[model samples]
Target: MVKKDTALGTGTMADRITDDEFERRMYSHDIAPLPKEMEAIFNTMPDFVVRPKSAKEVSNIIHVAQRKKLPVIPRGGASWGLGGCIPVKGGILLDMSTMDNIIEIDGDNLTATVEAGITWKKLCDTLERKGYFLGAYPSSAPSATVAGWINTGGVGIGTYKYGGAGDMIRNMEVVLPNGDIINTGFDYVMPNGSGYNLNWLFVGSEGTLGVVTKVTFKIYPAPEKFESISYSFNNLKQVGAAIHDITRAPINPFHMGFGDAMHYEYLRKVGIKAPKVGSLLTVTFEGAKEIVKYEEKVVDSIIAKHGGKSLGTEVGAHEWSSRSYEFKVRKMGLGAIPGEILVPMNTFSKVLDDTAKLIKKMKLKVPMIGSVADRNSVMVMPYYLTDKRKFVRSLTTMGFNKKFADIAFKHNGRPVGLGLFFACNVEKMFGREGSNLMHEIKSAIDPNDIMNPGKLVRTTTGFGFDAPGFAMNMGLGLLASVRSLLPRDTFGEKK
Candidate 1:
């Protein structure tokens, strides 16, 4: 626990706190490599970082943050492209990655209790060893934390069939901004029939509500089999149509993801072994052997009906295995900015068509990957490759995200999360009253407004100025328009 101090963080929570500039710089950003020029817009660095090993330690740290009235940003795997974990005011950063301990594996009760810092891959691997299954997990499981995914989008692999990470969570131990630790939901049974689901309140809250220290997730007995199959489509619209048909069918797939030929072409350019098919869709079914076999046949008929051809099981398994490394081609240039959006099946094809046109008009070398988030929603992520090393050019690339969100809005869809980059869209997505209420709720829970002070609700700069909502939209639009007039990219073309 940190002692009340006027100078800086003092005392000890197992002596894990650090005020060193070198270490503080590391906690400044997440997966997205923002250019140094962004320093002019915000204070991306943290003044201090503390690695809490237990919920009690986390609470202790929060208590100190309250006394000092400093913002406490909870950081897990740091895999999010958004600036959810970045501190705008350069306060204390709670590094949760080290507290990854599996506290309980209630096999009989079908629940696994673990520290929130546990990576999806680690938890899933551990559960598999006990003959249990983690039905829903993020595709970025290799580094994404359980709490991180829940806070980000709350949707990932097995989302279409078993629902998202929120559906599996039975309970969570959260440390509020006031340093009080509370548990939401039940231990073994599903939480229900309540006035409001407190668990859901924290879900997709983007760490502004509180720090999720521990969690209990409903687990399943290992499936008897997992069957994967792939199909090839002539174009992205055709692929979307087939997905629409398949999702409308009676059967439910464990997971389904697709990629256009251009995406694979880029992958192949980087020496990745991707199928040359114009468009690829991979589907997986998990359950009893007989049921999975039946599902494979049902899906085959659907694909055949939609002018698709089977790509054999080998390619299917390959695609499934590569879910976490979707952007291996990032090595070709600077890593991409993934504009993730969720659109309904009705407009999915149109969104795909328009997005392709948008990419062409912007003169970008982009590739798209999509998946069925649920029966009604599909998640489309367009990875626009850009050279962030070229300072001014990198700033222009941000325009793509703004324009992309506009496209989603036009088609009655929306961007995945309101992280720092997309904070201005809160009103557009949640409405004026709802957006105001969201900020009120934030103030209600965090009186000091120190829990991730500059994200989601609105962006704040280190200079203690809020980015005006109108200016945000206006600036983004102008940047995008400017990008449209810029020359085309040939960075990835064979020269």
Candidate 2:
């Protein structure tokens, strides 16, 4: 149990630092944290949240942290509700927000270069003026830093058309743990048969590998005309089938999302209403005026075949302007834990059915609202009945992750990435055998265990049967069955 009112603002190392120098460097930028937010994480409180104006300044801070042997957590926007931005080891919070600047916009080359801290919404605004756009439109667009989106594996409304954020990265300039700057991939239009494709490694590495200083990504020309269509279904089964058919169409959609009835009802309570509950599908298309109109007809045919009812309303041209701003709507004190799970396109229905059943079985007091991020990814925001109840607040993420992984594996789908720190305690997701392989990789790169020591790397510890938090997570009967499923050797082995 953490002390609720303890003044843990001061750590032993904070006292050792020269007061004059610390004070001088502290307020050179912005640093502010209220009591409620700071108290959530354990054993971590930054001495100062330092916002530097350039890559040189960022590299300098890393050098300073190394000299002091202080654990540093790099942060931007600070909009993440999870402990992603929290300094679990408690040292300096390196704020990269001040490094935000658009370095280049190659309209003819269809690429743009930008600093790490610019928000997605800001990027979109800038690109709209030039008639070019990027694909990573994660819900945190309004305030989330572009680097945060890349680091955390951003997926958004445009996924149906452009694919994941990792797919959009052309190259990047990163500041490593040793304070040396390195560019992962070549800055050319196409691959030049270079030595290796190191840029791909840092995409979802989450600041654990290095602090991204600059990025270059491919962009598309914005369509002059856009259309939004929402359809209602009597049940999720129909919604799933409708999406599958529409996505299989000859023409591609600009953006597409599927929201189950429960999600629509939740949105209704919050003053936004759509077609009646069982399921809702929103599809947007863009392109030449004639082409868009032609594809709209095919979409209508598919909808009719699936028995979808028109919601009697069309999202205006500006409707998707705020699509990425969904995070802001939920940030207003509504307790929600948004978990993203990716499954194979074929097994999507089974996974959803199994997940819904498990959520109901847990007797979770929170509403389980869900939406389809893309054909391969699903987003579920579990909401507690009340913000104060401990069980409801806990979100029971273990079940969703474990079950989803099983389904993904069975359907031949694999998890490419997950949002920040969840990978720290990610034994279950990777499992014992897989984690052993990860250990080997981590040991090779960070031989001294000096680079973000505990971020994504975990020791083998042999073949321990005990799953972290697994025993206490389930009810008595469920826990007994799970324990029984393991071999006795697993309980008494040291491999």
Candidate 3:
């Protein structure tokens, strides 16, 4: 039982704690609805929610939890549906959104430091006004927090050239599970001679190890010239070849994204006038005008050699400008089951083909989006959009989502982030040795298992690829057939 003392044995910081019903309900889940089939497993809600304004206050709260042997889950904007911030074991939910502050922008060092709760859009807008920008951001930037993305190993708009959030981070201040504060990266004052890269460990640890209080990210000057071009390919193989050739070329693109034929069909239904068939690839370039123009010429030649037809600059520019809006449109009162799989460039074509086969076998129609992270890898996102009010459809969607993740795993692709939903695959994702090392580190830092206990480690068993049986598959097929008869507008629209 939690101590009812308002002082919390740590003085004034205890006032931040609350067990209000309204707040607990609000913090219960994320954008993704809880699967009805697994409702009984995750039925327990958080016992209390705490909002800390400063690192000192956070330290106090964590120390109390450490002593009480209570679980603590750190929360940011809570925009993602991956269950990364869910308080599964009913303890304390650390709401970090209240710590929204941009602390510093060091022009000389080309770095920006901010509190954990600040949104990516706010940071990007602030830096753009000062003639600087983030190296990369997530698609949910408008609502996703800096620390949240850092914990999830985010990738987005500018990833093609600068890599993911991990590559852009220079340093960070983290509150350990035991309430001790430590600074990672090169410290100008009181440097430690450990010679270990501790900063990267927290990048994708999903907040199971500690609470990130502050982050310093490497920023870049705004590009002088920006241009985009689109290409239409007749087949998935051609699309893969085009991406491979462009990535290998000397020209570095600011962003590179593509959609399969089904994705374009969905766009057309939403009145975008997208192509009826074949794949669409969009490439955005930045830098000096002369250099951009020269790169576009070379890119055009490469696409032509790969059997791609130019769709002109108008379509590409429009798509580039509207990339972020897609998230908002998809989530407008609709149920969406989204998953991201990271695969090597060489297996891009095979992954696409295999995913198409699975969708066909399951009799499900969904839109898939792909992005080239760098020369060697790509990220593929396949999402199912359905009416949230339909109970059968929602449950079926969850089952199909698990099957899709299994397909990615079968093809040697791993999840982009391991939230509660993907916890079952931790061994497959990190291998036995890596998973054991993670467990060892987690045990050392949080011996009592107070920090996000059920995530990133195999501490609990719940719904996953093995949960639902043949009955769920039959239900999914029936629901898919019924959904086919409904109008496309039955799903939501951007407005």
Q: Against the true structure, whose TM-score is highest?
A: 1
* Per-model root-mean-square deviation over C-alphas: 1.8, 8.9, 4.6
Model 3 segments more than 4 A misplaced: 1-16, 187-194, 267-277, 329-333, 386-393, 459-495
Q: Which candidate, 2 or 3, has the higher TM-score? A: 3
Query: For candidate 2, what is the TM-score?
Result: 0.78
Q: Over the stretch 1-495, how does candidate 1's per-residue lDDT look in tens digits?
A: 233254344566646878777998988888776888888888888877889888888887787778778889999898888889998888889889888999999988999999999999999999999899988998889999999998885678899988887888899999999988999899988889856798888998899999999999999999999878889999878888888888888987899999888889888888989999889999999999998988889899989988999997998889888888887787778776778899988998888778878888878878889889998899998887767787766677788888888888999999887788778889999899999999999999987888988888888998878998889988888877778888877757877
Stretch of 10 with least lDDT, candidate 3:
461-470
Looking at candidate 1, what is the lDDT of residue 373? Answer: 93
What is the per-residue lDDT of model 3 for residues 356-393, given as tens digits with 9 covering 90 to 100? 77666555666788798888778888877755566655
**Candidate 1 total steric clashes:** 0
TM-score of each: 0.97, 0.78, 0.87
> Which ranking of candidates, highest TM-score first?
1, 3, 2
Give me candidate 1's TM-score against the actual structure.
0.97
User: Highest lDDT: which candidate?
Assistant: 1
Please give the lDDT score for candidate 2.
0.58
